[model samples]
Target: MRVAISRCLLGDNCRYNGKTKPNAAVIRSAKNVEVVPVCPESAGKLPIPRPAAEQRDGGVYMSDGTDVTRQFQAGACKEFDRVKKSGAPLAILKAKSPSCGSDLIYDGTYSGTLTAGDGVFTRLLKQEGITVATETMVEEMHPSVEHPVAIVLGTGLGSITDLVHVVRRIDYHDIEGFPDNAQPIEGHRFEAAIGALDGVPVIVYPGRIHLYRGYSAAEVTSLVRHAFRLGCRDIIFAGATGAIPGKVEKGLGILTDQINLTGRNPLAEWEGLRDVESPFVDMNDLYSPYMSSIARGVAKDQNITIGAGVFAGVLGPSFETRAEVSALRQLGVSYVGMSTVNEVIMAHALGMHVLGLTLAANYSGGCDVDHQSVLATAKRYEDDFQRWVRGIVHLL
Candidate 1:
């Protein structure tokens, strides 16, 4: 485990006034994992001995408010880029430091208080999928144990068609928007999902926001932010997809090993706005082989059929026609959908172990595709889906 660490924590006399924090765990982890020390302030070209900084109004800057936010952002960016090139699997940053707070950095009030803020480097590193852990969290998660995994179900599932044996039912009509227009806990959507899995111990984000909802880049980036805050080092996505025609496998559970997303990547720009280097999160080895083995094991136990392949992400609300399916097939898409890709990308970029499973409800309209039938098929498989998911959760 090649890990990126904060220079200040490593006893480097790199603080604005030439002081060091000297974290003990960093030194301990160094004995085991190869530790790469980095100071975003130094990386961004700020001299080793520099002035103290804080966040103000809308940006981070020097204490006297000379507006050195640009310099801090640039340094963070360069350090992040260097970390990526080193292929480090994890990062340990100082909490509450203007340069490396995972979250809750000081709000520049200079009053010794914390806020729902991200250090310039913290935000940038998360965008690239490097696992960010503060000193406190590292101690809490030091011990590894197996706990029940929780799988939360979102929208686009089989409706309550057959309520025969159902003893309990949550009315969807009374709950904002039931079948359609239902945005589950916007802003806190990830937290709500994590709450469901709280006692289970293992956390999973089954489905997330589609990029086409006209959401700003930051809003989308928050998905991973919240996940890390919840202490999750791994995330598995189980998405619903429309199968492309003549793709060999259609309307079956397709476990995607890769994603081909053509639109904008979340990390393509910063313009000295935030700390961190390049936004490119690594795609190589995005899927967890250990998790894959667990899923395959569950499949054998449940007698469920699952296909492993690539899932292509496309903007949607509109179903694809036969021609569109043909085009997608040529693009190497075995399954197509609107969600999951961005979430998976963000997770992998954050150095979280990512696994994606697509529940293909129907084949895109090459000849026989009906909305009613698709809903019915999804409904029919709900029980089976739940059982398989529970098994996977236990494995996680």
Candidate 2:
């Protein structure tokens, strides 16, 4: 894959301080791939050890109150043209930079405050339909993967399996760690399919056991371990969710991050796994931003209106109370669901890339919410969800 990257991330001393922000992970990921190094500031003819600048008031400026927006824009345009001509689909930029930040950058006071916004070059690349990521997202990009992607569906979303061209099937009872006597819950299945969806290799688990079903964290996450053991390195967790009123509209959404309100960690519960180097796993980027970007890009191309939001995973066979719903909304949660948290935690601990997709089947704290209604609502989005998943797999 050809990727455009900030020159400084590859150890180029092109910053205003005449120093490089070398990242080992980014460098390692760039191996064997076509990399186009770019530095907007240097391309603008800004000298080494030049005045440090920040974006403020819709413009770039030096700390001493000198405007440099023109130079930044010029440099961004120059690099944008070059990257576009290279036909690179992705760009890995330096985070929190004045010209390269993709998600957040300095608030322009020179006080080290950060704000949510893209940098100059990032904006240009994005406008041209190029996917932009940061050094922090490199690990999730995995230049290539020979293993099949895993798809674990949660309540009422099992229809996605119907689109797969199956090569084989496995009974849940035969899968190690899966409860032998466990029965499938309403709207769930108890089988796994090894198949290809849209010509992409994949393993599909049509349903999962949840915490409220009296399953241990390890039991709930057995699918994750099984997927990893089956030579899968990427997993997609899709489920039904309750949309918080006014926070997210009822439909399909992508999980940006998650709050594990279920209060359980699979690393602490799964003691049989002896391969874990450490139980102390970093949760940052657990819901892969790189994959999420791909999902978003597919959504745009397919004309599917998918919202992005934070998910709160709770311990539940029962629906949330009004007060609980209010608390979750106050916590900035856009969707509330009963699954995916433990599964995601286990996937991350096992060194797998995760992408969480959700179906907002109902409104949280609604009086008429039930499993039947949730399933019915999910059916309304079945076509779009299938198309969305297929597009994502094709891209992967």
Candidate 3:
């Protein structure tokens, strides 16, 4: 894979301060790939040790109030052309510069305030449909994991297991804490496979136990514990969800964060609490933004329409009512489902990086919501879901 990166991140002294902001993590990630170094300011013929610039009022301006929009655009165009010709699908740029910031750039006030917008060069690359990430995002992409990635499939979404090359299979009954007489409902399976998907090591559970099924939080999360014991440090939780009316479309959605309305946590009075100093695990970034970014890139590469939003996990063996859906929408939820909340909580407590993928099988509060329809919808999109999961695994 070829990647375009900010020249300064590769240790070039090309910033306005004439100093390099070299990043070891970025360099390490680029070591094996063909790297195209880009310095938009330098390409614009801006001298070293020049005044710093920020984006404001639709133009680039120096700290001293001098307009440099033309030079910045000139440099961005020059570097963008080079990157375009290189055919690099990905670009890792500086986080907050007027020229290369991918996510947020400094506000024009020169007061160090960040506004949500891309830099000049980044905007050009995005316009051309290239995947743009920052140095921090790159770091998240390469987490330290020596074990296989774990995957837990939810109701009607177990077809992903068909694509795995199974090395071994285990019955869920043998897993500790699993119910003795556990039987999968229609559209789910009770088996686990240790295998490789597209040559990527993985341990896949074809179905999961949910809290609504008279299972304790600990019992519902047994698969997570087993995966952790097997040395898996990264896990993907894929499920079928109901789209929150106008908040999310009925297709694929990547979980950016979650609201646990299930009212039960896996770590509540569990023996696992003895191992950690505090039971209060920071829920921030619980869904792993790094993996989410990779998922977005995969969706873009494959031409799949996917939305990123918050998931509301409820305790449900039944679909939500109209009033319930309204409450969820007010909470900023895009997708709503039952299984992933406890599993995700347990996964995070175990220090595993998580990536959540949801298929919006139906619109919440729709009069036609039914299990049969959800299964039918899952069947319709199974091929795309498999492809998306495989693409993300390949990148990992």
Candidate 4:
């Protein structure tokens, strides 16, 4: 694959500050393909360590109020021509700059606020019908569809493994960058399986660690990050929770929304995630409407009742007390659990379409229950759970 890239991203000191914005992700891709590095500002005769520039009033201007619109435009044309002559079909541009920004740039006010817009050179390339993406998005690009759907099975809901034609199995200890203490549950395997479920490629994590297990929030949902690296654009999270009694019953439900009562967020680890453009990813309609609708229809067709409700995530190895349940009921939580929320946060941060499903293992408010009973109930509905996953897989 021949691709165009911003020179600064390729480690050239071409920025106004004379510093390169080196991204290991772009460099990795460059190793496997031809990378045509272009620095539009330098091409326009702007010297390294020159005045900083930004887009304002639809024109390029220096920080000292000097208008460089003509020079920027001229360089944009030249860079476009170079990319055209190279015959590159794809490009990875720096995300927030005056000359090469692809997704967002500083607001004209120069207050460090960001707005959606393209850089001068990016606009020229778009006019030529070239596909342009940010450097952060480069890691997910692949020549073939290897990872399509990601499923994280919670507690004892991992029976989906039996139906999948196994392709690859990677253990947690073997996964790169996971915390040292990140181990799977005693009975459930600590591994990820890449396989085809009813002919649809999917990656399944049979068991997930929890916040109560002395793991950091990022450590709890590290599998989500791995899934993005595997090129999965759509992810499904299936977990077990306790029902809120009247609002929802003990069976299955689709998570319409979630309240992060765990007091810990996976995105708080953003300072360590230099590969992403930003960690404050939007959570609007966080659960994919299209996937949820398909799941709803599948449940009905398979004679399985699927309810929709808000889920409240708590930090717990201990079950919720009667008082805690009442407080959650006041907040309109139909189900409550300990896992799934952190993974959901990480999944959305990576721009993947998310689908969340929960099995109501018991009445959370005041039910006399034990973990053994919960696991037994989950195993009991294994057949129905598999049917629902298969029906949804067919749609994907």
The candidate maximizing TM-score is 3
- lDDT tens readout by residue for model 2, 1-396: 567888999999898989999998788756735789999998888778977799999999988798989999999999999999988778889999999998899999899999999999999998997878888766444323357889999878899888888989999888889987789988899999988887778889999998887889989898889998998888999999999997998889999999999989888888755666655888998897678877886787789999889999999878999999999999999999999999999998888989999999889999868889988988888899999998787666
User: What tens digits encode model 3's per-residue C-alpha lDDT throughout 1-396?
Assistant: 567989899999999999999998888866756789999999999878988899999999999888999999999999999999998778889999998886789988888999999999999998997877788766654533348889999878898888989989999999988899778887789999888898788889989878888898999999999999988888999998999999989989899899999989889946879887877888887987657766886787788899878999999888899999999999999999988988998999888889999999999999877888889998999888999999887776
Q: Judged by lDDT against the true structure, how good is candidate 1?
A: 0.61
Off by over 4 Å in 2: 1-77, 80-146, 272-277
Which regions of candidate 4 fall more than 4 Å away from where they truly are? 1-144, 275-278
Per-model CA lDDT versus the true structure: 0.61, 0.87, 0.87, 0.81
Clashing pairs in 2: none
Candidates 1 and 3 compared by lDDT, better number? 3
RMSD for all candidates, in order, please. 13.5, 7.9, 6.4, 12.4
TM-score for every candidate vs. truth? 0.51, 0.72, 0.73, 0.63
lDDT of 4: 0.81
Span of 10 residues, lowest total lDDT, candidate 3:
137-146
Evaluate residue 148 in candidate 1 and report its C-alpha lDDT on the 0 to 100 scale.
18
Error of 1 at 225 (Å): 2.3
Candidate 1 residues lying further than 4 Å off, grouped into runs, are 1-154, 157-199, 203-207, 269-273, 367-373
Instruction: Tell me how candidate 3 scores on lDDT.
Output: 0.87
